[model samples]
Target: MKLPLHERIRSEIETAILSGTLRPGARLPTEHELMQRYDCSRMTVNKALSALAVAGLVDRNKRAGSSVAQPKVHSMVLDIPDLEQEVVRRGQRYRFQLSGREVKQPDPDYPEELQLAGNSDLLRLEGVHFADDRPLACERRLISLAAVPDIAAQMFDKISPGAWLLEHVPWTEAETRIAAVAADRTIAARLELPIGSACLSIERRTWRGADGITLVHQHFVGTAYDLVARFGPAKGSTGAEPQQL
Candidate 1:
């Protein structure tokens, strides 16, 4: 299906802002530039920019033109965590050991595995994070090849996938889910814990605009690990968005 011209323009700009290419308060392209780029009428470009203003993603000024808007709220927020930083910040040494790596389609035979990039082929990885030479977390991740082609060449031997991605990728949005669960046999052996020991399980997904980037699951020994983050409120968050926990 063909997208409307104004929608396409809006999506392109939104993707830039979300991916950090267009930071807050950055000047947007002039109407003349947009018209020349998209080969559209001024009205079409104006419609697209107006939609962005309404959504609070941009601020329009008659004299200064349009610029990316400031965040809408100041409430506390939690963010996707980097396990290596978590350990190193506590004055412990950190290392990652890769157990498996493959390029495969989404959805394997194992129901326990998850890949949320729809039909995109994924760079699947499995590894363990060690803090001061003790197993700290077991990680299973799927990177969307469509979204980050450069990742396929990474050797991940000297770094964890999460850390590498944090440095190299720009993500628009992310979702995290937390659960307390009994360690399954696979995770128990990997983390060197008795089966059924309590563990903290976190599953996170990140994206660049509409294209999915990566989904990862990290499991930690509940007695030994903690996840923490500091953040400001999400842009345009309101009573409409989910409450912060």
Candidate 2:
């Protein structure tokens, strides 16, 4: 099966944006120019750009033409089931570069950062996550060893810890906090990004059953990634506004 022409074109543009060749607010070529460049009809160019616009990659307007939108801060409130299904449907080859694992007591070095107690049984793991061969994210996770025993024997080489646990264990709930942060030296090196680059940091905790706290995951996202949501009213329309905090 081959990719549709328009999808291929859209992917090309997306790659350019991720690689920083198409900076924020940079105007994309006109339909005529794209037709010439891709050797396709106006319909093909229009379809390609339209798909990009729908995906929040570009802003297209009759008067303003088409240009890259400034990258948005993402808030992905994903239903876990849907995310798992989507990943399976994509049939993408995945890989993980396991950094290391440590057994230690928790610390309060970054209090504002996920606040785990200092005396808690901590098992820390670090790695770079990949989709196919592309570096997707730098992951640093801390698991409560007392909560999930035998975690040290589990190998994350063939599957992500998150996905693996989701399949093998039953989780009741998860809480997450997302924020923007600048990449540090270690992350920059791992993600092949420049130092001080903007990245999204997500902290999450998952609970198993009623009393078991399973894991804590921290994801550092690179450019071209976003968390999206479908918005609607919480109840009947009134003076209330959408709450984001």
Candidate 3:
């Protein structure tokens, strides 16, 4: 489906900001300039800018014009325990099955957030994580071969891609997005849930410096697990509460 004129304009600018073409505090084009460039009216341009401001992506001032907002960084520590260990800790037998693995080029449909260059092979893996022989999560991952060439030769039958990457690769940074989504036919079957069941979906991307390392999406049965993160001050620390993002 085609985006409305204002939304298309918003998306283009958002893409530039996300792709680092428009760095923090960089001034966006004047409203008149955007109007001319997008062949739209001033109202349309203002609407797009308004949406960006509401999204916390840009700062707008009547006299100073609009500029990209400084990206806020939050320190969130999540317990990404190994699935096998987690199940064992709960006194349940743990098992995993590597359902599929292949080396292939990323298709056009690949997410733009990964910022991968064209014409590079990616190692795709699909599997199911189980506890007490009951499926708990469905895993889909894409590993950049350019970043970790040795990954293509490893057989993942005995180890998960996430575990192997954590052991072998040194990542400088990671980002995660979490949401609740309804299970489709494929995910429902893999996680042994009814179709349209509520599931917790997590998309994580790890990076080594400026290079992309891996992107993985894991879907867990919502009723089977609860995602938890702890937040507090360090020992002997005198500081204000961390700012919300």
Which structure among the candidates has the greatest lDDT?
1
lDDT tens readout by residue for model 1, 101-159: 99987667743234454556789999998878888889888888866777888998887
Question: Model 2, stretches more than 4 Å misplaced?
Answer: 1-78, 81-91, 108-120, 209-217, 229-245
lDDT by residue (tens digit), candidate 3, 130-239: 77788888898888887677787888778778878867665545777889999999999998888999988988887644668888899988788766555543111112
Rank order by lDDT, top first? 1, 3, 2
Q: What TM-score, over all chains together, does every model reach? A: 0.68, 0.52, 0.61
RMSD of each candidate? 8.1, 19.5, 14.6
Model 1 residue 15 CA deviation in Å: 11
Candidate 2 minimal-lDDT segment of 10 residues: 236-245
Q: For residues 44-112, could you state the per-residue lDDT of candidate 2 as single tens digits?
A: 989989867765678998987899977564332233322223333456445777888877676657552
Model 3 TM: 0.61
Show the lowest summed lDDT stretch of 10 residues, model 3.
Answer: 235-244
Clashing pairs in 2: 74-227
> Which of the predicted structures, 1 or 3, would earn the higher lDDT when compared with the native?
1
